[model samples]
Target: MQKEELYKGMNPLEAAVSGAALEGAVASGLSDPFGSLDLLTIQVTPLAIGIRADGNNFVPIIPRSTTMPAQKDLIFTTAHDNQAEALIIVYEGEGKKVEENHLLGYFKITGIPLAPKGVPEIRVILDIDASSVLRVLAGVLMPGSHQPVNPVMGVRMPTVDDGHGWCAEALNRAYGSTLDLVTVHKKI
Candidate 1:
């Protein structure tokens, strides 16, 4: 199935919360306080890589990989009397799974404030590399078609302004794209 099709009918926040709870259970070997493990079992219905956390615990799952370039959304909810935190790792470059595993970038969210003892969600999107894989798969699956050539570099830049002009500029040059800026000023 196509990667995009996986996450078409799911809520991002709900996905994140479920992902986090699953990972938390695996990583920490702890039971969920909310008694909602059933929801967490629903196959991650998104086409992206995600790591969810319940406090310090986490779990990693990717519905789509480099062969699939579908964006996915994830959510993680914290239990009462606790908070949530997470680290997401992305791997890029040419190599087998063993080799590529070492080359990765980490996105971390820390100290997510505690929600009232029910469920609060943290949402994120996962965009995979379907275009690249499509080319490769097409060539192999359908010979005489154009052979897929892996790009020299494949990376995604963050959309939010992280207060680094040079970094954004560099990213723009690399991707041949422009950034849209929205500035808000508050009067004291």
Candidate 2:
């Protein structure tokens, strides 16, 4: 085998030993070189993921630069009166508007049991692993209900390519607030 080829195929342990030997040979009392360097790599989220809120705004659940294997939950409510279902649209980006972001995917929680607007509590849970796989959980809680409805959908991130804005608009046009949700903000 060629000398360069033989050296290029060195295993991690072998490369570490050789690098240490070279560093020792180059060591000098002048100053410690390679300082302020990170020997280990840091894990981070590639994109900011969040749900759409009122006024079509993007409410970030997990912001960018967050470490991996992160999870977050946000409470939401129906946008219209006596809503029976809530649609959750998940997007990924740094943009404040959902139209400017990429739609990862969405799920709907039905059988909310007829409640006034902002009365039913819909919980949106986002779970992201180190591999960047995202799983979303939507739980709808209504008064006097035995349990939350089923049809819980979990999907991988980045489910859509182009035309995400059009998709959102179409969904709204078809559903007409039947699956709309808004962030539930409490004062004090």
Candidate 3:
């Protein structure tokens, strides 16, 4: 009831008692004090989103339960001598193994300058918009050029409906370590 109408048609003592009881209910968390219809709630991701690197390892980009509208980037190196490209296979979940995770999709960034293994820097970027749309971008810098090459290729996630495991296997078999990412370094 409106504040003006709450005490209407009631004795002064009755109105005061009723008001005190209502206040107690609210303060004690027995009732929602704000009865207005307008309310706002924040949303978060239910699972972690990430990519599969070499050795079937899952590298998390946006961790589980993180607030949406997020972006992250990770640096990786080619796993083979004179590697020409890097594959970015996106996945979702908390699993440590790539096969245990749900495959979203995959993209390849080609045209990497030929260099000894672990010499080139390949950057993988993940961006989640406010609407939960995901974007994968990969790029690299040439040995001599100062300008960075924009993503040679990209794809929206969750594009693979099934057979993702086979796809990953086939890619690994065909490319071996050429398109794989070098081992990630951990801080001591």
Per-model TM against the reference: 0.29, 0.69, 0.71
Locate the minimum summed-lDDT window of 10 residues in model 2: 29-38
lDDT of 3 by residue, 111-181 (tens): 88788888777767788887789988877865556567654455677657365477767766886655778
Q: List lDDT for all candidates, in order.
A: 0.35, 0.75, 0.75
What order do candidates take by TM-score, descending? 3, 2, 1
List RMSD in Å for every model shown.
Answer: 22.3, 12.6, 13.0
Number of backbone-clashing residue pairs for each candidate, in the order shown: 15, 0, 0
Which has the greatest TM-score?
3
Q: Model 2: what TM-score?
A: 0.69
**What does candidate 1's lDDT look like per residue over 14-71, in tens digits?**
8889878676675565766777553433232233333323322223334433344454
